[model samples]
Target: MMTEKQLTDALRRRDEAAFRELILRFQPITARVIFKITGDKEETPDLVQEVFVSIWEQVKNFREEASLSTWIYQLSTNKARNHLKWKKLRTGFRLSWQSEQAQPPAGMNHSLNMALEMFERKDDENAITMALQQLPHNQRTAFVLSKSEGLSNPEIAAIMKLSVSSVESLNFRARQNLVKILLPYYNNKKS
Candidate 1:
């Protein structure tokens, strides 16, 4: 088996086999991370492909300071965030046009499908998702890494380029905010 450096060197040299090996090895993990961040299965496949393409383009500059997996995680995270931001911008534009025309947007049905309605009818999962979406980007990233991805605070800190204590603080605040948002619904469900 080739070391990560060897694989990276091969990729830098544009070795097809090495690229295939890298993709086969990392694609599932990349797809999972993208899905967790965006919660969109349809988009995850293409996004994962884009991330690998980025990795291929940037592999030459990869300093071996961090583990390859960490580098890949960082790349995927940035790509996913950028994609989400673009999506939000596009949605905003569509919303504006719909308001002008007095018509529902083309993708409103999909948006409704992706909404937090499950929180109203079911468990805390969708509520967590909704609360996560409400959080600032860094806070949400920290929270998701800590909770949904089952990463330690230190690992999240490394991936997010923040201190461990900052990751911990973000996680704490995220939990507080989530609880505050969900408590009423939770109590009503029990009652």
Candidate 2:
């Protein structure tokens, strides 16, 4: 297998095989990031395709200031963020398109698990998505990257071009806001 530098060098040279290898290697990760941000599995494949196209076109500008994966994370997040903006503009609300049966992440805290469980009833997976959408973009990004994608705060900070503390703050705020938004639902479900 080619090293990351070798793959990037080949891509910068406009190598078709290297591009194919790039898609094969990065597509799954790119898809996961996009899906976590957008919550739309149907849109994920197309978004992943767009990310690869961007990497192909932008490889020459890659300065190697960060690892290739970090750079790709930056790209995927930017793409997903723009997608969310366009979707909101079109729909007049932040629409979430989650799977039929959304499973809570293994690393989730007890409160978050309880919050998600409250949405497990028929066709209510959207409650989780709606609560996530209530967060600000930066907070939502930090939360999804940390909680859903299992990315480290430093990794999220790098991708977001923020300090580690900022990522932590965003995540903290996100969790607090999610609880505030979903607490009533959890209470109502129990009653």
Candidate 3:
């Protein structure tokens, strides 16, 4: 496997194979960051592709101060944030995915999104997913990066351009707000 430096040097040389290698190597983390931020599985694949394209265009600007993964996460997060902003302006970030939708592609589990946590019931999992969407974007991003993506607070802070303390605060508020919003469903599940 080529080291990150070798891959980056290849990328800087405009080597197509190196770009493909970069995509293959980083797509998992890239998808996680994009999907978690956007919270829309249907759009994630396309957004991820767009992220790679964006990366290709901006490879020359990537200073090696951070790991390649960190750079990719930063790019993916910004893309996802921009996509959400455009989506909100277009439709106010409506929750009604079923209202006017196209058929999902084959082999895609439209029922479960990429976060991929197991729940006893699909409904409960989906309910939590919906509640997550209603959170302030900072809190949701922090929570997803910390819990679902298993990134350290410092990593999340770096990706989010916030202080580590701010990331901690966001995580705290995210948990509190999720419980506040979903406590009824959680109680119902218990009983």
The TM-score values for the models, in the order shown, are: 0.77, 0.80, 0.80
Backbone N/Cα/C clashes per model? 0, 0, 0
- Per-residue alpha-carbon lDDT of candidate 3 for residues 75-172, written as tens digits (9 for 90 to 100): 88888878887887899744223211323332123323322233344554576666676566677778888888899999998988899998998899
RMSD of each candidate relative to the true structure = 7.3, 7.6, 8.9
Worst 10 residues of 3 by lDDT: 99-108
Q: Give the per-residue lDDT of model 1 (tens digit) for 86-115.
A: 887978622111221332234333333333
Give lDDT tens digits, candidate 2, residues 122-142: 445777675775555677788
Ranking by lDDT: 2, 3, 1
Error of 1 at 133 (Å): 2.3
Q: Residue 167 deviation, candidate 2, in Å?
A: 0.8
What's the lDDT for residue 145 in model 3? Answer: 81
lDDT for model 2: 0.78
